[model samples]
Target: MFKLLLRRFFSLTLPLALICAAGFGLDWSALALADQAPPGAQIFELHCAGCHIHGGNIVRRNKTLKLKALQRNGMDNLTAISEIVLNGKGNMSAYQDRLTEAEIQSVAAYVLEQAEQGWK
Candidate 1:
């Protein structure tokens, strides 16, 4: 009876300990780095330029939201941009499901950089 109880306790506790360790490892990985844009500008062209003109698509109806405009609107920072992409505003759709969190962070960084440097 003693051996059986000890075996059962070890079996349950070992799995629980392993599970807790795995969860901590995953959480650390998730928090490891600040999201940055990918190496190329394709993400901006494909996902952002439709409504924002600085990346090069011509504006049709919506206001030409370039880096300058974003700055003027007080949204020319990476964090703001990321939040906007993830949560969306007005006619824009949330991109949390479409793009990875890292991708969104990268694009936001790119846009903020351009805004700060005057889009030259």
Candidate 2:
């Protein structure tokens, strides 16, 4: 009886311990939280606001995120903006590794929306 109980305990716990050691046993709450993607404005604030505050570029005056500049630079659409956010352009850093595809798209949409709104 003692040996059977000990064997059952090891059988149940060994795989769990192994899974945790392998980093598969993530916290359920953390996983749930990670499953939720942040909104576009939040993402933009966290990543792009420093350089492109209020849709204005601090580095290059001509390459601002405003409607006029975006239209002139051929970045007036979501695809163009998303591509730039993923691959980056001059004076802008790429966020392909730091953000997911959906996040990039969200921020791109946010930029276009804000541009249309005149950043108000």
Measured against the true structure, the TM-scores of the candidates, in listed sequence, are 0.55, 0.68
Residue 84 of model 1, lDDT score: 84
| Alpha-carbon lDDT, every model | 0.70, 0.93
lDDT of 2 at 97: 100
Model 2 lDDT tens row, 1-120? 999999999999999897885697557777576556468988998899999999999988899999999999999999999999999988899999999999999999999999999998
Best by lDDT: 2
| RMSD to truth, every model | 12.4, 10.3
Error of 1 at 108 (Å): 0.3
lDDT of candidate 1 over 1-120, digit per residue (tens): 999999999999999997998986766554444234353245776888676656433544433346666766567677888898889876667999989988888777877766666656
